[model samples]
Structures are given as structure tokens and as C-alpha cells.
Target chain A: MKANEVPQDKSSLDSINQKELCYATDESGNYITTKSSGWTPKTIALNNAIEDIKERAEEAKQRVLNNETSPIEYYMELNRMDVTILAGYVGIWPFRVKRHFNPKRFKKLSDKLLQKYADAFNISLKQLKQGDLNED
Target chain B: MKIDFKHHQSAHCENGVVSNLMKHNGLNISEPMIFGIGSGLIYCYIPFLKVNHGPAVTYRVMPGLIFKRFAKRIGVTFKREKFKSVAKAKQRLDENLKNNNPVGLQVGIYHLLYLPDHYRFHFNAHNIVVYGKEGNNYLVSDPVIETVATLDEKQMEKARFAKGPFAPNGQIYYPISFPKESDIPYKEAIVKGIKQTCRDMLAPIPIVGVKGIRMVAKLIKKWPKKKGIKVANHYLGQIVRMQEEIGTGGGGFRYIFAAFLQESSAILNNEKLMELSKEMTVIGDLWRDFALEASRLYKNRKATTGSYDKVSEMLFELADKEEVFFKTLKKAIK
Candidate 1:
């Protein structure tokens, strides 16, 4: 795409503070090095990813409020994790973790399992059980 | 204990780190030039390997290969180590910094505190330089960021020990000896780099290089029928992310390679290379077009204005263009 046709999303452009240098060919096909104002397509991809994560976190919060799943499930989604990754972190089988997604099963989880989860998430057991969503 | 290291931002991590490290050792080379000499560009799609739950599509070679290849090509000796213990790794890094040596590190992006939250992912191949240490934070020169940043001790350790595919394992590297700038055979290295890149693009491997592009195009054609619209779109998005999001210099390293050609043209005093460089920029634009269209399909979700076939055809055209370009480049450089 032509440089003029490059996306000019001001909000995303303003998000970058560092003013990194980038190399690009000018309109006359001359190579030039210029400070990036963050109009690159990569910035747009990053914005999309952030929006997706936020939406997932919001949906996960709703799921926890409705008691459709346990807080563990909510935290997993908040961390951008699936059952496979959470299981790997917690040293449990993915199938078992899927079962733990049910509030009834999560409540019955032993202290050992809860501690494992807390450690995996770098949080305390109390915080894990309470489902605190605050970033540390 | 700060070392006098100048950090220059780059389009890709490894290339940037390599370029900056070389310059710090008194060898001035542009990031794209290092990328070209290292033969960093590549195209591969693996169905079984998954990144973010979609098939893995990579635009460059694996991490550390660039540094390794570039150093070897220029006869520079370097040292690389992977620690079994984080504390040992920290000690070594500190020792290097104390001696005024800037050290390169392979760390996971997720735990890199300096990156914006939106940009952090589980990618573990991210490269940075740790040049000094304060009370509790290490002075970091992350090549992608605007300025040199700092990472706390705990966060640095976390990033170094981040577990997953391609974990860093506290990997660190630094130059042991530097060759004089006059010792580098720039023209010969440029020719070899160009030839190797051509081979990569024209290789017969169906799952790699230009053929890999065609293979992915064919897979894109089949995705909707076999995996349904949502899954197909997800895979397509992953491909675009690999091309555009991941430090690919805005078109799967095409622009960077074009820039490399431009610099090499001047170095070798070859007008033919200058013309080839312009052609490369055009190819980079085409790749961007492919990314834009694929991203549109990914966002549509409804399959309204975009289709898998259309995206695949676009990729096929790109593959054809790249094939012709590489063939011509091989003859021109020879």
C-alpha cells in the first residue's frame, strides 16, 4: 500500500510514545529512515488483540457473576489461557481442569489443588478463591 | 553500571539486537543488512504446530539463527550459553555488565514489563540486550521499543524462565572478539546472502519458501470446506498476524529485504540490484494487500464480502510473483 494510503488511526498512533525509527520507501521509491508515528499495520493488529482480550475478560466476568462457571475459569480467560495451558501450569489433566470449571467441582477442590492454582497464577489461595480480578 | 551502548529501534527483534550488538562492538551495519546476510527471511506453515490455537505460520527463521549465521559469515567469534538456574544466569549477566559488555538475551514477551499490555503474548523468541544493572532493575535495550527501558529483577527472571514452546532457558550471548570493519567481505557476503535467499524462495519443498506460500494458499482454499468459516477465518488471521504483527518489517520481511538490497546495491556499485530492490518493494506491497484482505475476512465473521477462495487466490498470485522475483534475483546476483 502507498504511504498516503496507510492507516491513520490517530488514537492508535498516539498510543506509541517512544517514536521508534523505521525504514520505508518514499513515494519516489527512495529509501528513507524516519521516526514511526505508529501508523503501521502491526499497530492495528496489536489494537485488535487487546480489544479481543478485553472482550474475553468481560465475558468471563459475566460468566462468573451468573455462577455458570467457577472463578478459576474466569481467571483463566482473563489470563488469555485455555484449558490446555491452565492445566499445564497447574499440573493437572486438561479433562480434570474442564471438570473444575463447574462451580460445584471447583468448590470441592482440595487445598493442594487450590494452592497449585494460586501458585500458577502467582496469587494467594485466598485471592484465588475470592476471584479477585485486580492486576497485581 | 551502565555500558555505553546505543540502542536503535528495529522492525524485528533478532535483527535489531544483532545490528545493535555489532555496532556496539564498533562494526556499523544496518538491521536489514544484518537480516539479509543472516538469511533471515522465510515462509513456513505447519498444520500440527499451533500458536494461539491456530496453525503456525512463521515469516522468519527461528530465534538466534540470525546472530549465529551473521557472525559466522563475518568471522566474528561469539559466546552463547543457556543456564539451568536463573540465579546463575543473573550472576553471569551481571558479570558481563560489570565488565562493560552488553549481553544479548532471549526472553519471553509475556513477562517483559516494558511492552504495552496489548502487545504482550506468550512468544518466547523475543531478543533484547541487558547492558547494566541498578539496585533492582536491569537496564534493557529492547530493539523494538523507542528508548532503552528497565526491567525489575523479578520480572527479568520471570521472562527468562518463562515456560512454553521455545522457552528462553536464560539464554545469553555476546561477542567474544570483533573483526575490523575492513575485514568484512561485504560484496561476497551480499552475493551469498542473496543466493541463499533465492534458494530458500525457490526450493522444491512444498511446505517451505515460495512453494510453502502456494501450499498455504491451497490450504486456505480447503479451510472453509473442511474446518468451517470460523475456523478458517481463525487460521487466516493467524497467517496475517505472522506476516504483519510479528516483527516482519511490515510484509513478511519483504520490505526489510528490499532495504537490504538497496544498501547492497550501493555497497557493490550494482545498478541491477537497485532495480531489483524496487521490485522487492512492490512485492512487499502485494504482500500487504494480501494481509489487508485476509484481515478483512477475519473481521467479517459473517463471510459477507470476503471468501476463503478469494484470499487463497491472492496468495497464489503472490507466490507466483515471488517465484519469478527470486529466479530473476538469482541470475542478476550471479
Candidate 2:
């Protein structure tokens, strides 16, 4: 049930097969195996916890979008949001130039994101450019 | 503070009006070597005279002067002619033949090759001369001779016959000289090429100001990926730094050398790589290292320093460690 409760020395534990971890039917009427066979128990638990956090963060992001009083404050808050929020859908890090990364797909998605925000903020692209260039 | 015109001009004009011009300019003219045959010629004064010992020819910085007159008359000749023994004359001739330009007579002690005791007369002219022993008697031959004949009975006994015709009088030599060029085409071509290339590459950026890193990064981004932009960035910094350090007197050749070395080191063979390495101290090695690092990080490849990374690092570590290599090079040049 807990990591500490597992055997401290794995050497004395008789491997059910030649492998220390293996697939086997348990007493419970369901498909079951040693956690280490396909994935560690710790990894599965961490992934679930991460998903829960991401969902909560996304809900908070939507609420902020719906009740935004100032756009400047909203954009700043949006910038603070990490990529992990929508990472479930993307399944990969955006803005990464990896060997396997499809640059065209990433660029199209980024453009769409920029367009949505540009229309929402009521800021012209020229004004944005001037602001960036004229920044202190 | 007055200009010495006499030191400047080797020859005077036929009308002597040049001296009047020199006086008007507050200059004096003298010294044959300094100004020889310069009258009526548009002489470009050589900023520096570099004598190449390899060919025994001097490269005058002023191309015009080299082509005009010095190219013909500049030659090497012996001081005097002396011969004590047969062997001495032969040795002297051997030395003269080896010289790029050999002429005139030089007097020195002579050692008889055949006869140890009796002294022989040696003359150095266009050839060498020896008038002493072949075997049991006296003989004489031209310095150019491969063989010598002993005087026969009639020749040895008779006084008139002993004076051999083959003996060199006062002439034996080789001439060291370069073919005169009416114009120095090579130098002109080099200068023209430099000006053209400089205009194309540097004309866009007119400021004699610092090339900050952000602008350099933008420039690097525009460069082709295959061109090793990181390496170029390092050198672009050094190039601008070199201009600021040395000023325009040195021009962009230093930067050109740096850029060429940076790009060439990546693909060049070991021999050529080492050859270029000598010309590029900090800029080359640093840019090369930067390229290698970028290749490793961005391209997922091994370091470009190859197996000799440790050695290259150690050699470049001196000025490169402190990042003052260009400055050090500027100091050395100054």
C-alpha cells in the first residue's frame, strides 16, 4: 500500500519468475501484475496526481478568462501559466525544436493562439511591435 | 623637423629645378641607396624594406620603386681576389657557385690540394683559377675545369708555356637577380581585391562603434545553418573588436583571416588545419571551439576539436581563458 512497507532488501524476496517483476493473475478477479513489470507504482501514482493538479489549474485558468477585469493583468497571468495545463492534449512540449518535432504543426497552433489573444486584447499587431521595440 | 630632401632623392633632374621644388617644400635630397634613379619617375616610397634571405631578393614595400630601377642593379659580389694554394681556390669557387649571385675577386689563403708545401696562385673572376701541382710538377686550369693536366717536359722546362691560357684573369661569378616588372601586378591585384571585398562586407555597417551582442546574434540568425553561425558570431565579435583595437590602419585583413580560419578549420585536413591554426591564435581556436560546442549541443554530434581537444584547449587557454586574445594580438602587432 505504501513504498516504505515494501521489502527493504529485495534480495531475500523470492522472484515469482526469473524476473524480479512479472505479470500474474492475483486472488482478486481482475487483471493484475507486479507494478515494476510495465511501470513502477510510484510513476503511476505521480502521473495521477499530476493530472489532478493540471485539471484544477485549467479550471482556474478558465475562471480567470471568464471574469477578467483588466486585459493587461489577464495576459500577465496567462503568461504565468505553464505548458502542462494543456499538455495532455498536445502530448508533447510546444516551442521545442526537437529532431522528431513537426515545426509546421507547432507554428500553426502557435499562430492560432496568438490570433485569439490579439483579437481578445483589442491590441493591433503594429502597436504590439512598437511596444516591444520601445520597451524600457 | 625639416624634411631632408637630399636623403630622399638619389638623383637630380637635368634642369636642377627639382632642387628648387625641394627647397620650396623644405626638403633635402641625398643618399644614393635611398633615392637612386628616382628622378622623373613617380616613385612610391617603400614604407618598409623586407629583404628575403631565401632568394636573396629584397621586397620593397613600394611596388613602383621595385619595378623602376632597384630590381636590375641589386646584386651580390665578392670583395677581393686572393689565392695561396690550389685547394683554396677550388673551395672559394665552390662557395661562389653556391651563391645566388657571385661575382668579383676576393683574396684569401689558399691550400694546395695536390702539393702540400708549395703555394699556388688563385684568381676569382667569372671563374676560379689555380696554378700549381697536378703530379710531380705544376699545372693550371680554368676554375670551371673538371680536370687538370700536369705540365709535360717541354711545358715544365719552358717559362713561356707555363703561363696557361685557361687560368682565370679576374672574372668568375653567378648573378642573383629578379626579372624587372614594369608594374607590380600582384600587389595591385591584392590591394584591389581587399578594397572590393571590404566595400561589399563592411559598407553596410558604417559606425566606428561597438558591435553589440544582440545585433551580432540577429546577424548570426540570418546566416545559413550550414555556415556554422555560432563560429561566425564569435569571429564577428573579434572582427569588430580588432577594428576597435587596431583602428583602420590595419584594415579588415585581420578579420578576413579570422573568418577564413574559423570556417576552414571545421572541414580542412590536419595539415591545412595546422597551417591555418598558426595564423589564427585566439579568434580561430575560440570560434572553432564555439562551433564544436554548438554542433555537439544542437546537432547531437561529438566535439569538433576531435581527439586533440585537450591539446587544442591547452594551447588556446592562455589568452582565450581571459577572453583577451584579440587584445593581446593587437598589442603584439602594435
Which candidate number has the best TM-score? 1
lDDT of 2 by residue, B206-252 (tens): 22111122233333343324345334333323222222111010111
- Regions of candidate 2 where Cα sits further than 4 Å from its true position: A1-136, B1-184, B195-214, B218-281, B300-334
Q: Ten consecutive residues with minimal summed lDDT in candidate 2 chain A?
A: A11-20
**Candidate 2 C-alpha error for residue B148, in Å:** 56
**Docking class for candidate 1:** acceptable
* lDDT string, candidate 2, A55-119, tens digits: 54455445444542213223322222222211211233433313112323323445444444343
**All models, RMSD in angstroms:** 3.0, 38.7
> lDDT per prediction?
0.80, 0.27
Tens digit of lDDT per residue, candidate 1, span B275-301? 999998888888888877777777767
Q: So what's the TM-score on candidate 2?
A: 0.16
> Residue B300 CA error for candidate 2 (Å)?
4.6
- lDDT by residue (tens digit), candidate 1, A5-121: 444433342544654455567788777655555544455555555566677778877887888888887777667666776786676788998899898888899999999888767
Per-candidate iRMS values, in order, are 3.1, 44.0
- Candidate 2 at residue B16, lDDT? 20
